[model samples]
Target: MAEAFKFELVSPERLLVSEEVAQVVVPGSEGQFTMLKGHAPFMTTMRPGVIEVTGQSGTVSRIFVRGGFADASPAGLTVLAEMAVPVQDLKAEQIAREIKNAEEDVADAGSDETKRVAQEKLDQLREVQAALGAPAAH
Candidate 1:
């Protein structure tokens, strides 16, 4: 039987998930990474993307996380996402609206730093939209 490890997914608003999972895939700032039972202890910054968790119950779930931190240890993994939502809960229209707002912000930002920040937000929004099965924005 495959080994299982404790996995917790948390957001500012609430604890999204807490269970024994066979494996989990996280989107690290450097790149995508996976965690399984007995993984070496480490901590890394996370990026905006989908987190995939395969639970002991044989169910797979996905969460859209917008930046945070992930801590992995031999005993378990903990994810502290700045914001997270179940894939099913994502709305295409909402994402599209956010993208539009970000684009407007990018256009109106006065300082270079502000523009850069807006661009990053737009990129993250696009990533979420893509993960939600929406076609890429032109």
Candidate 2:
């Protein structure tokens, strides 16, 4: 059996998840990475994407997280997300609206640095849209 470890997913609105899980896949800024019990400790910033949690009982739950940092330590893994929502609760229209907003942000950015940052966010949102199988945001 896979070792269980504490995993917590928190959003500004509420504590979304607090439980022991077999594994968790986080959408990091560099790329997605998985965490398991006794994994080496590290921290990373998150991109806008889905977090996959595998429970000890083999059940899987997915949550969408945008903007956050993940902390992995000897104790456990904790994700402090700016926004978090159950994947099942998300609507395609909602994602599409967000993608549109992101595109606008990219366009309205005043400076090169700001535009780069906004473009990154827009790209991340588009990736999430594709992952959710939503129609392309025009």
Candidate 3:
């Protein structure tokens, strides 16, 4: 069998992925980076984007993350995501609904800071939708 490195993906709900893979590409807040076996130890804040993985068996998977952080060490790569889902299962309609709700929250916000924070959340959601190639939410 081919040598593989451990990869773990964690979301608030549960451990989403735990496997031995050949490679992983994480969307760091600074930029996207790929990790292979024996990668240098490092850490980076994550952005709303895709996490690409190449399994030991050569199958590829794409997982979308809202945001969080990624760490790479001699043991392997670990991703702690705020929210994550397999790209194939993501639904545009659901994201569109979230955008609408966030808009409502912004309008109902009482304080200036609250309004700004709500708007920022809405913007991040929109960015994720766009990155997934979904049309702008109506």
lDDT scores in order: 0.87, 0.92, 0.88
Q: Rank the candidates by TM-score, best first.
A: 2, 1, 3
* Candidate 1 local lDDT, 1-138, one digit each (tens): 459999999999999898889999999878899898999999999877899998887788988887899999877999999889887887777667768888999999999999998898788779778767876555
Runs of candidate 2 with Cα error greater than 4 angstroms are none
Instruction: Please give the distance, in angstroms, between residue 19's alpha carbon in candidate 2 and its true position after superposition.
Output: 0.3
Task: Report the candidate with higher lDDT, 2 versus 3.
Answer: 2
Supply candidate 1's per-residue lDDT for 43.
98
Q: Candidate 1: lDDT of 11?
A: 95
TM-score of each: 0.82, 0.95, 0.79
Tens digit of per-residue lDDT, candidate 2, span 1-138: 589999999999888899999999999999999999998999999999999999999999999887799999988899999899899999999899888888899999999999999999999999899989988877
Q: By TM-score, who's the top model here?
A: 2
* Candidate 3 overall lDDT versus native: 0.88
Q: Summarize candidate 3's per-residue lDDT along 1-138 as a digit string, tens digits.
A: 346899999999999999999999898878799999899999999876789999988898999887899999999999999889899999988678768888999999999999997887788778878878887887
Clashing residue pair totals per candidate (backbone < 3 A): 0, 0, 0
